[model samples]
Target: MADQIDDVDFALAAYRTDGEWVVAELTHDHLEDVDVLSAALRRFPGDTGTLGLVAIDEDFFVIVRVAGTSTRLLLSDVTAADEWELAASVLDFLRLPDPEDDDEPEPAGEVGLLADLGVPAATMAELIDDEDLYPDELLSEVARRIGFGELFDDVVGLTSA
Candidate 1:
């Protein structure tokens, strides 16, 4: 699973402080498990909460939002649980059943996680449903919607300059 853990393309924690969005790179160690990731996120001070955006192997992504003691999660592709330890851990954390080999790839968890922020669940669903885009791209869109596209793009190297 160490090899798979290393497959993380990027892991970031984003939050709003004094009405401004702050994006920071998360340590790879936090990528080992969902609980650890959540705990790590809580350390960040934010007006709303902390969002952990993790893209793995360019195959799928996991979004975790932590506020106080509450944590909401989203997995871009549930089927990824079959082969990824991190994905599987997300399912376990959510108390969701593991995906079968025949199960279709779909997101799991609260799509409305960012509803109160501005990006409705419908918009998030549209992004997640587009199979052609990579996890980083989808995450970039989310950041863009929430007011930090440039910062996110710069961190992920999606922007040229």
Candidate 2:
């Protein structure tokens, strides 16, 4: 089987309105796939515009076009023959943020807080048993009533536990 990309190894490379590149490492348990990332760029606030995969190192770098600008990122640090380092160097040449930096938070707005919440399996089961409430409606109502962030936290906590 092919080795799966770990969550910590992936970082999001997006562009800012000032033409600067932004690299935010993903901290979630699972890494976002290309399709999901593309969707996120479309939904980002302030008309940042769409994102497209431009180039890949075939080892580490996965360069993308965002809002008509090209941005590259180090997708992993497991260098077999300096490929990861070379990708990082290229990213540096492009003035992107270092993936090693933990100062910046992960990219937001794609997976809503509900997905992150740890709702209990039993609670979910009970909620599902309610014939009057669809799962989507229940989630939406929960999101609306207690705030999406809180709902996500609760769901995440419940599920993870």
Candidate 3:
């Protein structure tokens, strides 16, 4: 697992359990910190589930975990523009559902999964204002699309109204 973790850049602490790849935690000194990215890579244990990154430029990174295997691309060489492009590509690749599907789904209501992820209500509201946090319906669609089914499944239990 440790050896597998050493292969990526920008990976910060990963672990595997019951054949599920879990990126336990990650930290970045700055949006573009290389050492932090290196540390992140070193922390990966091996791919079994999925590797997800909430990048600075609205970019999301995904890795398919498999033991002793490199199932994803290295992040070290990606430019900011590329990262955003990759993020969009990944989201599209995963076939995340669109927010506009089915009459917009009532503005996602208030009980959103992002809130469950510990994003402050005020902050989330602000993000929504800026169109950063997708509407609830779209968010759910995206969550399922991004291989966060487990996390999304547990969202109701994790959030507080």
Candidate with the greatest TM-score versus the true structure: 1
The lDDT of each candidate is 0.91, 0.34, 0.34
Worst 10-residue lDDT window, candidate 1: 1-10
- Residue 150, model 2: Cα distance from true site in angstroms: 34
Query: To one decimal, what is the Cα RMSD in angstroms of model 2 from the true structure?
Result: 15.5
For model 3 the local lDDT of residue 47 reads 39
TM-score versus the correct structure, for each prediction: 0.96, 0.27, 0.32
| Best first by TM-score, ranked | 1, 3, 2
- Write the residue-wise lDDT of candidate 1 on 1-161 in tens digits: 57766688999999999999999999888988899999999999989789999999999999999999999999989999999998999899999999988999999998888988778999999998998888988889888888888999999999632
- Give one digit per residue, the lDDT tens place, for model 2 in 1-161: 01334312333333334553332333322124443444455444323542222222222223233343433222222221132333344334445555543332222112222232344444544443455753334443433332342333243332311
- Ten residues in sequence with the least summed lDDT for candidate 2: 105-114
Off by over 4 Å in 3: 1-16, 20-23, 30-39, 47-50, 57-71, 74-147, 150-161
Encode model 3's per-residue lDDT on 1-161: one tens digit a residue.
22223322342233445665353445333123332333345445543423433323222233222223333322211222232443333334334433332332121223232333344445434443444442332333334444454554344122311
What is the model-wide C-alpha lDDT for candidate 1? 0.91
Where is model 3 poorest over a 10-residue stretch in terms of lDDT? 73-82
What C-alpha lDDT, on a 0 to 100 scale, does residue 108 get in candidate 1?
A: 93
Better of 1 and 3 by TM-score: 1
Which parts of model 1 have CA positions greater than 4 angstroms off?
none
